[model samples]
Structure formats: structure tokens, C-alpha cells
Target: MRLAIIGGLAAGPAAAAEAKRRAPDAEVVLFEQGPHISVGTCEIPYLLGGHLEPETTLQVLTPEAMERTRGVTVHVRHRVTALDPRRSRLTVEALDYGSTREEAFDRFILATGARARRLGVEGEDAAGVFTVRDLVDTHAIQRWLDTQPVRHVVIVGGGYIGLEMAEAMRSRGLRASILDPNGRVLGSTVACEASDLMDRAVAEAGVPVRAERATEILAEDDGRVRAVRTDRGELIGCQMVIVSVGVEPRTELAAAAGLRLGDMGGVAVDDQMHTSARSVWACGDVVQIPRAPDGRRVLWPLATMARRTARVAARNAAGSASTRSADRFRPFAGAVGVRAFGVEVGSVGLSLSRALDAGFDAVATDVRHVSRTRAFPEAAPIDVRLVSERGSGRILGGQLVGREGAALRANVLVPLVIGGGTVRDLAEDFDLIYNPPLGPAVDPLKVAASQAMRDAG
Candidate 1:
């Protein structure tokens, strides 16, 4: 059996390795358009900040190593232009060869992730504006930083990538300014409260944020970006600009092949990662997945979901009886954990506003406490807002903001909600580990849960 997988970053490589494990005799091959395969996209920010070195950014597993160790072939810089499902073949263009080739496969997996979004503005194609999605983009920006006297940077977007790049550019001694059309910093991803927290952090760090604004990149004499003009009648002076508005799944190949696309603008797949087409599967950021709290298909671009879905695709492709585990098929565990400015802020599940929108009577309780023991040294005030169903006391969602050990508690709320545990469950039966050097004797989660249950009654 011959199996072919496209886009050998996280999902493609995972499916290949799992297929190799399931069917040792099967011939499996994966293709990646980039120079390196199986690189961690989430570590890009740390790499830019010098927290992680670029030399160690790409996880280099040579094709020879994969072939010898796992019986898989990894072809780098091989771009699949088209897929013929009827013939079970892919039209691949190898950039190094300057030629196209057709490869046959008995089974195929489409994990061709997403591309960075671009602005349609007149001068957006100028030399200094770039996106920071892939390693190549990161390298390009880093190389430019090394050569240019970049004193100011204009980031057009307030999403995760844009905010991280702002911090990274600031660390590089550049005056970083963000221009977001949305009223809040994180916009749709985070609630207004969390957005305000980020705004405060950015302000304290001396980073400039122009909210409710759009940009028009203006070019200088050499067709290079000189400044960014906003729709709100303001011009931000900067030579370098980074735009990370958002991403759309690269599903053109799959859509052309008669596969289903989801409302979330990604490929549609079943719980087992099988697409509508026979013997074809999809995963990663390309697939629209079930959202938590409700079962709506949402495209959550976290790495964890991609890996789990890849295992399902690999199992089916290898003719194994294995199915996607229940844990993998569920909605996003609903956690966006972030820490900045000597403070931690996190949100999980649905916010009170979201729960109300979803036709649930949501009640929220705001609790404040010292992160450490009251008398302990370096204690910081912690604030938690616990949201629950008004009648049932079921823990629906939560938000945590404080200094020290606070962001992690938001992670704890996700599993509780995912497992269908209620506020009563947390209030009465939650077991917490405690250490004077780490956690308080009464865990903040339990404290919040108790308050939630009391309010529910």
C-alpha cells in the first residue's frame, strides 16, 4: 500500500509516522513546501525574542533518518498543486527541479495548513511589509532586522501573532506600534476584560496601540513602506510593518477535488478525520473542528488538536481498526492561556456573555484573593470571575487575572467543563495539591467554585 500526505509540518508528519507504526510494510511519503519539515509553529515568538535560539527552531529529521527509522519518505520543497481523487494521484511541483511530477497513491491525506492573510491596500506589496507565519517569513524578518536601521515598527492587527511580534520588535530596540480595527486588543479571541488587561500591559511597557483603526501602507520613493496611514485620520511613521490579521485554511486543493468545506472556511471532516471523499482525510488548521460548550464546528488553530486528528487519519489510512478517540473529537477544551507584565490572565470555555448568547442563563461571580498565602512573601492579588449556569450550578466558563500562579488555574477549569463536572462537583470533591513554595492550601479554583455554587443557590 502506498500512502501520500501533503504539508509535512505538524499534521502531515504525524500521520506519516503513525501510519508507519501501524503498517510497517506500507510505503508512506510526506511532502512539505518549506525547507524544513516538522517545525513547531508556536515557538516562533520565543525564537524572535531570543528566548529560544533560531538554530534550534526547526526540528530537523532528515529524510534518510525517517526512512531508516520509521520507513517514511519526507520530500521537502515539494508543492502539491492539484489532487485528482478519481485517479488517486497528486500533481506536485518540485521547486528545486523547476518541473512538475505526478505521484500515485492508494491513500491520501490533505493536511495543507494555512497561509498568512494579506492586506489588499495599494502599497501593501511594498518591500518592508511582511507576515510572520512560517519559518521562512520569520527568517526574512530577522534578516531584515539584522541589516536595517529599524527604529519604528507598525503592526496591523491585534491578534496573538501581531501582539507577540510587537513585543519581539520592542525587544529588538524598535518602537512597536499596533493598529487594530477592532475596539479591543485581542478582538474576538478574548473577552473585553482580558483585552483591557492586555491594553494595560502594553501601555505600561510603553507600546502604542491605536484601537478601532485600519491602515493604508504608504510607499516612499524606492517602493518601500515609509509609513502607515490609518482610516481614523492618523499616520503612524514606520519603515517596517508586520501584518497578522488572521489566516484562512489552504483548502483550495481539497475543495477542487470535491471535498466538503466547513462554514469556518476550512475543510470539513468527521470525528475520525475522514473527509467526504473516500479514502481521503484532513486535519490540522485546515479542518473545522467542534467547538466546546456547544458543538459548532470552529477552526481552532492550536497544535494539540492537529496532532490528535493526525492519529485518527493515520489509523484509517493504514487499514487499522482504530478510531479517533473521544477526547480528540470533542469541542476545543476552551483555554487561551497568556502571561505578561508580571501578571497572568486566562479564559476558558464560554464567557458569561457567550453563554447568554447560547441560550443559557449564565451567572458569574467575581472573587479576589492573594495568590500566595496572605502572610507569605511576594504575594500578589488574584482575581477570578467564575461563570456558571444559573439553575444547575454547572461550571460553564471562567477568567483569571493576577500575578504569579494564576494562568494555570484557568487551564484547570477547561478539563472540569470538558468532563461535565459542575460547580458543586468542584466545591465538594475537588482534590488539590499544595506546597508552600507553589500553591496555596485552598486552591483558587475550589475557592471560586464554592463561591459559584453559593451564588447558584
Candidate 2:
């Protein structure tokens, strides 16, 4: 059996290794358009902030190492220009030599990941504008900082990356400001109270956020960025601009090959991670996952979903012939959108707005509780908002924001929400321990869940 994989980032490489494990004798190959593969994309910000050295662990595995250890062929700087699902073949371009070649496969997997979104405004191609999504992007931002006198940086989005880059720039003694048209960070995915907590968090970090649209990028005579022009006809001065708005799935190859795509703009995959096309599947940020509580397909560009879906796609493709597990139809497990920040914030399943959009009569119950008891010195507060369905009393989702346990609380919410647990289930059935200077007598998660049960009643 011949297996061909497009993309060499987190998902693609993982699928290749998993395939090799499942079918040892099968010929497995992975292609990455960039010079590097198996990158630790989440570490890019620390590299920018000088917290990490690029020469260190930023790149997880090299092409040579992957080929040597995983028993799979790895190709870097190879671009898949076209894919023909009917023939089970693809056209690959050697970027270095500018030569094209055809490869045939019995099974194929696409982990094309995502691309940085552009503002579509003029002067975007100037010298000092950047998007720090990959190793190459981090290196480019480093090069800009080294070559140019960048004392002031304007981040164009207030999402996770934008907020991280803001702290990263400030840590480097650069004045960083956020320009978000949505007037808030994290968008509408977070509950209203959580958004308020995020606002306070960024302000305390000394990052000024401007709630306005950036209409254009102004550059100097030498084609270097100078300022950003807003829709209100105001110019926000800056020497550099980071475009961290967000990312969309890179599904051009799949779409051109007549593969189905979900309304969420990701390649539509079934429970087995199989695309509509025969003998082909897609994972990573390119594919959609079934959101819990309502099974609505959502394109969440999260590493956890990418890896889980990759395993399903790989095991199904490589071990399809085996009747070892009759119902080997594996779907992605539960997933929640989580971001690490000074004031960490995360949401699982659905927000109140998303519940309403999904045609559920839902209400969000907010609770503020202490991280520790009063006896503990300077116990911090945790903000949790639980979203519950009205009549059914099902636990739809939750948003948590705090400096201490926001991310951990989010992890606790995932299993319960995915298990179809109800408000009462979260409130009483869940085991939450308590200790002074560790956690309060009644955990914030339970407090919020109990509040949600009351609101439902």
C-alpha cells in the first residue's frame, strides 16, 4: 500500500508516523511546502519575546530525523499543486528546482493546516508588517526587529496571538497596542463577563487596545511601515505591525479536487475522518470537528483537535482492511477552545450566543469565587459563566477567566460537557475537592454549575 500525505506540520507528520505504525510495510511519504517541518508553532511567541532561542527546541523534528525514526519519507519545500482523487494521484512541485512530478497513492491524507488572514488593505506588503504563525514567520519578525528601529508595534487583532505578541513586544521594551474592529478580544466565543475580565487583563499588561477598523497601512518612502489608518480616518503611529487577526483552513487543494467542505469552511469529514472523496481523508486545522452538546460541525483550529483527528484519519486509512475492531469508526473526542494568557481564558462546547444560534433556549449563569479561602494570603478570584439549556437542563458550555485556575477549570469542563452531563450533574455528581491555600471549600466550577441549575429552575 502506498500512502501520500500533504502537509508536514503537526497533523501531517503525526498521521504519517501513525500510518507507519499501523502498516509497517506500507510506503509512507510526507510533503511540506516550507523548509522546516514538525514545528512547535505555539513556541513562536516565546521566540519573538527572547524567552526562547530559535536554535533550541522551536523546531520539534527535522526531516532527516522523521525519515530515520518513523520509517517514512519526508520531503520539505515540496508543494502539492494539484490533486486528482479519481486517479489517487497528485502533482508535486519541487520548489528549489522548479520541477514538477506525479505521485500515486492508494490512500491520501491532507493536513494543509491554515493560512494567515490578510486585512485586504493597501501597504500590507510593506517591510515591517508580519504574521507570526510559523518558524519562518517568527524568523522574519526577528529579522525585522534586528534590522529596523521598531520601538512601537501595532497589533492588528486582539485574539490569542495578538494578545501574546502584545505581551511579547512589551517584554522586549517595545510599545505594543491592539487594534480590533470587534471592540473586544476573543470575539463572541467568550461570555460577556469573561470578555470584561480579558479587557482588564490586557489593560493591566499595559497594552492599549483601540476598538476600530484598520483601513490601510501607511509606509515611508523606502517601503517601510509607519502608521495604520483607521476607518475613522485616524492614523495610529507605529514602526511595525503584527497581523494576528486569525487563520482560515487551507482547503484550496481539497475544494479544487471536488471534496466536500462544511459551512464552517473546513473540509467536511465523517466520523472516520474520511472525506467525501474515496481513499482520501483530511485532518488538522483543515477539517471540521463535531462540536459537543449539539454535534454541529465547527472548524476549531486547535492542536488537540488536529492530533485527535489525525489519529482517526491515520488508523482508519492504514488499518482499514483489518476486522480486528468491527466498529473501528472513531470520531474526535471532546474539544474546547482554550488560550493561555496573563488572565487565562477558555470555553468548552458552546457559548450562550452559540447555544441560541444552535436553536436552544439557553441562559448563561455567572459566578465569581475565590481561588482559596480567606485564611490564605491574597487569594485571587476566578470568573466562571456556565451556559445551560432551558427545558432540557443540559450543560451546553462554559467560559472561565482568571489568573490562577482558568485553564485548568476549562480542562475539567470538557469531559462533563462531552458526556452530555446536565447542570445538576456538574453541580453534585462531579467530585471537586477543597483545601485552604489550594482551592475553596466549594469550587468555582460547582458554584457556577449550581448557579446554572438555579437559573434553569
Candidate 3:
């Protein structure tokens, strides 16, 4: 049972490790184009903030470690240029030196991850402009900081990566500014109120956010990027720029292999993470699955998703008798914790507008209260909005904004969502722990539910 995994990052390595564990004698090989595998994308900003050492986060697993510990052949600096699913083979190009070869596998797992999206704007290729998506990007930008007189930085995009990078650069004593084309910061992921709160938090950190602004990078006379031109005709000079627009799935290999591609531009996979082609599977950012809220297929890229996908894909790849099931994989439960920036904002399930768009007669209730016991020292005001079906009172979605610890409180809604608990169920439910210092007399969940009950009437 020979298995070849195209990527050695998050999902690929997980699948390889799992497959080896499932079938101890199985021949498993993991190929990575870069020097490292299993690197943490979330910690890139922390590395920039000097919170972590470069080696601590960059190389997740060395080839020597993977080979010796996992008994798996790990190939670094190798590219799988082409795949021949019909022939059960793949063409590999060794990047270390001049070498081309073909690898045959009884089973194949395509875990190729997504890359950072580039705007392709003028001066984008300049030395000062960078994207913080991978370890190399982090190293490159950090190296530039050593050589360049980086006093000011302009961050393009207001998404998760953008916000994290903004904080990282600012904490390092660089004057950071974010230019977002959206009307509000993090508008694509968070709702209006949460976005505004985050914006305020960023402002408090001395980071200015330019909203609804498009940027055009202008090169200086010395062929270096000097300033970014905006739609408002403002040319802001900055010594460095970090562009973190978003990510797109790398599905060219999947598409060429005649596998179905989803509307979200990811490879289509079944519940088991198996592709349309037999003996082949796909996972990670390159595979789009169904979102629970709307039953629509979309790419919800996250480390959690990568890990789960790896387990499912590996089971099928190893031909395990106890195959994995879809129930093991749940729609992503994600939130953007704004508490790190001073305030707390948490969102889950879906939004009111999205619920309505999905054909639900939804009504939402907004409540304000303290996040902790009233007598607690640092009890901050908590503002929450919960959306429920107008008549049925089915819990659809929720958002929380408040002081620290508010994000963790919002996580209580996850089980309710997964269990299909409604406003009525929450109103009558009695299932939670309470400590005076950690919570109020009445849990915020019940308080919000009771408030929603009133609004439902």
C-alpha cells in the first residue's frame, strides 16, 4: 500500500502521519516544495511581534524528524509538477538540483494548500511590498526590516491576516496604517458593530484605518516603493507594506486530473474526503465542503479544518475497514476574538442578514449587560445580538462584544447550535456552571435567550 501525499503542510502531514499509524507497514511519502512542513499560519504575526523565535514557529517538522520518528519518507524542496490519475503516477521535480522523476502510488492524497492572493497592482513586486502568508514571507519581511529604514508600514486589506499583521508591525515600533476597501474593518467576517469595535481598538493602539479606500502603490525615483496612492488622492508615504487580501484554493492539479471543482474554486470531495477519482483524496484549503448554516458549499479555510480533513482523508487512503464518516467533520465553528485588542467581539453560526438571505424569517435581539459579576473588579459591559427564527425560535446565529472573557462566553453557543437548540430550549434550559467571579447571577446565555423570547413575542 504505497501512498503519496502532494503537500507536507497542515493536512498533508496529518494525513501522512495518520495513514502510517493506521497501516504501520504502509509505504507513505510526503512531499513539500518548501523547506518545512506543519508551520503555523496563525503564529506568523506573533513571530513578527517578537513574541516567538523564528525557529520556534517556522519549521514545524524537519525531514530528519519525520523520517526517523514517523517512519515516513519526507521530501523537502520537491515539487509535484504533474499528476496522472489514470496511470496512478505523478511527476516530481527536485528543486535542490537538476532532477526529474515519476513516483507511483497505490493511493494519492492531494493536500496542496492555498497561497496568499496578490493584488497585481503597480509596484507590487517592489522590495518593500510583502505578503505574510508563510514562513518564507515572514522571514523575507523580517529580513527587509533589518536592512531597510522601516519607520512606517502600510497594511492593505482588513481581514484576519491584515489585522494580525497590523498589530504585529505596530507592536514592533513601526507606525502601522491599514487601508481597507470595505466600509468597515473585518466586514467580510464580522458584522458592522463588531467591525466598528475592532476599528476602535486598532485606533486605540495608534493604528489608523482608512476605510473604503483603494490603494495604488507608486514607485519612487530610485525604483523603490515610496508611497501608496489612494482613491481619495492621498499619497501616504511608507517604508514598508504588507498585503493580506485573502486566499484562493490551489486546484489546478485537481482540475487537470478531471475531478469536480466546487463553486468556491476548491476540489469537490465527498464525506470521506475522497475525490471523484478512485484511490485519490483531497483536503485542506483546496477542498470545499458544505457549510452547516446554509447548506452551501464554501471554502472555510482554517487549521482546525485542515486537521479534521486530514483524519478523514487518511482513513480512506489507508483502506481502513473502519472508514471515517461525515458526522466526524462539522461545519467550521469560528470566531474572531477582538479581546486581544482590548475589546471582545465573537460571532458564530450566521448573521441576521445571511439568515434572512437563506430564507429564514429571522428576528434578532440586542442586549447590554456586564460580562462578569457586577461586583467584580474588571467587569466590562457586554453587548450581544442573537438571531432566531421569528416563529419557531430556532437559534440561527449570534454575536458578542464586550470586555475580556466575552469571547469564551460566546463559545457556549456552539453546542446549542450543533444540538439544534432553539431560543425556547435556551430559555428553559438549566445546563451550565457558574462562578461569581467568572459570570453574573444569570448566565449571559439565558439572559440573551430571555431577551430573545421577549423580542419573539
Candidate 4:
């Protein structure tokens, strides 16, 4: 089998490695347009904060290591310009030398990933404005920091990237402010109470946040960002601006090849990660897969989801008989975590608003507990919230907020929600580990589950 994978950042490399492992004799080739492959994009914020070294972030998987150890052909600085699904061929270009060639493959995986969404405001082309997407963007920001006197930074979004960058700027002794179009921070993913907590945390870290949209980016005569004008006619001055509005799937290549797209604006793929075109599969941020809670197709764009879908796509491409079975490939339940302003937050499955929107009578309960026993002097407060179906008590989702152990606690609910466990089952049957230094005997998860059960009743 000739397996060709496009876009080697996260999923493409995984697909190539997995395909080679499954079928040793198969020819697996991976192509990445950028100079680097398998970058840890999630750690980019830490690079700005000086917590993580730049060299460490670029060491995910070198092309030479991928080829030598994994037995996969790794081609960096090579872009796949066109894909002809009917002919099972790809037109590639060598970026450095301006050379083009055609490669035929028996199977192909598209892991094209996503690009950062632009603000599209006036003066967006100004010099001091940047979008955090890849290593190049990171280098650009670092160069600006070194060359310019950037004392204050204005972030134009309230999502994870915006929040993380705010924290990073604070660590660098710069004034960081976030301007969000949404009324609340993390409003789309977290509940109002949790969002309120995060707002307070950011405020405590000396980062000013405003719930207003940026109307335009005003630039000086030198074409550098000077100030940002808001909808309320306020101009906030800043030396630099970071836009983290979100990301959109890079699926122009797939669309040009006549591949079907989902309602979420991603390449449509089935549970087995097979695209609409035969002999081709799509994974990573470029594809929309089923959300396990409601079985609705949604764009997760998470690293964990990317790797899982890539493995499934690779096994299928390798013609593994066991992988062809329906039961082996499970749908993805969205799980995500973020740390900002010394607070760790995590969420799994759906928020209460999302559950209600999915046509379920959902009720939620929030419980506050000490992470450790009261006798422990280092005990910190942990807040947990659980949402469940009103009548059936079926667990739907959960959120956790704390200085520590918040992400791990939220992760425990993922399996329960995926396995269709009820709130009562978690309250009565779940045996969570207990240690005085780590957590109390009565786990916070159980407390949230028990409260959710009562709220539902």
C-alpha cells in the first residue's frame, strides 16, 4: 500500500507512523509545507512567557528522526498543491527550489489542520498585529518583543489563546488587556459561574478585560499599530496586538476536489475517519466528527481528537481487518483543559446550555470542596459542577476550577459520560482514589454527582 499523508503537524505524522506499524511493507510518506513538523502548538504561549525555551517547542519530531526511527518518508518544505481524488494522485511543490511533481497513492489522509481567523478590521495589515498559528508567528512576536518597546499588549479575544497570552504578558511585566466581543470570558465553553471565576482570576493578575468589540485597528504613519478603536468610541493604546478570534478549517484543497463539507465548515467524515471521497480519509482540525454526548457532528479541533482520528484513519488505510469493525472506532467526546492566571480549568462533554440546546431537560449542580483534607495546611479550594438529564439523571457534562487537580478531576467524568453512566451511578458506585495530601475522602466529583442527582429529582 502507498499511503500519503498531507500536513505533518499533528495528525499527519501520527497517521504515517501508525500506517507503517500496521503494515510494515507499506510505503508511508508524510508532507509538511512548513520548515518544521510536529510542533507543540499548545505550548506557544509558554514560549512568550519564557517558561518554555523556543528550542524545546520545536523538538516535537524532527524529520530525520521520523524517517530513521519510524520508517516513514518525511518531506518538509513540500506543499501538496492539488489533490485529484478520482485519480488518487497529488500534485506537490518543493517550496525551496520551486519544483513540482505528481505522486500517486493507493490511500491518502488529509490532516491539513486550521488557520487562525483574522479580525478583518481596518488597518489589520499594520505591522504590530499578529495571529498565533505556527512557529513563524511565534518568531515574529518574539522579534517584535526584542526590537520594539512593548509595554502593553491588547488581545482581541477571550478564548484560551487570548487568556493564555494575557497571562504570558503579565509574566513579562507588561500590561495585558483583553477585549472580547462576548459578554463573558469562555462563555461558549464554560458556564457563567465558572466564567465569572476566570474573570476574577484574570483581574487579580492585573489584566484588564472588557466585553466590547474592536471596531478598527488604528495605525501610525509608519504602518505600525497605534491604538484599537472600540464600538463604544473608546481608543485603547497599545504597542502590540494579538488576535485570537479562533480558527477555521483549511479545507480549500478538499473542497476543490469535490469533497463534502459538514455543517460546521469542516470536511465531513464518518466514524471511521473516511472522507466522502473513496481511497481518502480526513482527520485533525480539517474534519468534523461526531460529538459523543449527542452524536451530532461538530468541529472539536483538539490535539487528543486529532491523534485518535488519525490512528483510526491509518489502520483503515492499512487494511486492518479488525479496524474495519464498527465497534472498534468510537466517536469522540470533547475534552479540553486550560490554565490561566494561576487557575486551572477543565470541561468534558457539554455545558448546560449546550445540553439544553440538544433538546434535553438538563439540570446542573455546583459543589465547592477542599482539594485536600482540612487538616492539611496546603489545602486549596476546588469547585466542581455537573450537568445531567433532569428525569433520567444521565451524566451529560462537568466542569472543574482550582489551582491544582482541576483538569484531572474533570477528566474522570469523560468515561462516565461516554459510557452513558448516570449521576446516581457516579454517586453510589464510583470509587475515586483518596489521599489526605491529594484529596479528601469524599471526592469532589462524587459530591457534584450527588448534588446533581438531587437537583434533577
TM-score of each: 0.93, 0.95, 0.94, 0.96
Q: Candidate 3's residue-wise lDDT over 1-457, tens digit each?
A: 8999889678888999888987899999998898887787788888888878755756677779888998999988999888888899999999999699998999899999898888877678776899877878878888988888889999888877788888888778889988887744666765544335566788899988887454578777776678888888898998888888888888888888898898778998887888899879998889987665556667877777888888888877886645555324566544445444666677877778877888888888887777678888888777778888887787877888765666777787776665667887886875656677787877777888998987876
Q: lDDT for every model?
A: 0.79, 0.83, 0.79, 0.86
lDDT per residue (tens digit) for residues 244-363 in model 1: 888889999998899989987899998878899887888888998876666777787767777877887888777654443432355676688665445577788888888788788889
Sorted on TM-score, best first, the list reads 4, 2, 3, 1
lDDT of 2 by residue, 1-457 (tens): 9999899778998899998998899999999999987888887877788777656677788999999999999999999999998998999999999999999999899999999889999999998999978988888898989898898999999877787788789879889888988777777434434447778877877788888888999999999999999988989999999998789999999999999999988999888788999889889999987877777777878777787778878888888656324423333324444443367777777878878999989888888888778688768888888888886678888888877777677778777677777889888888887888788888999998888887987
Top candidate by lDDT? 4
Task: Itemize residue pairs with steric clashes in candidate 4.
Answer: none
lDDT of each residue in 105-139, candidate 4, tens digit only: 98899999999999888988899999998888999
Q: Which residue pairs in model 1 clash with each other? A: none
Question: Model 2 segments beyond 4 Å from truth?
Answer: 189-192, 322-341
Runs with alpha carbons beyond 4 Å of true place in candidate 1: 60-64, 191-196, 321-328
In model 1, the worst 10-residue window by lDDT is: 320-329
Off by more than 4 A, model 3: 53-55, 192-195, 320-328, 335-339
What does the lDDT read for residue 64 in candidate 2?
96
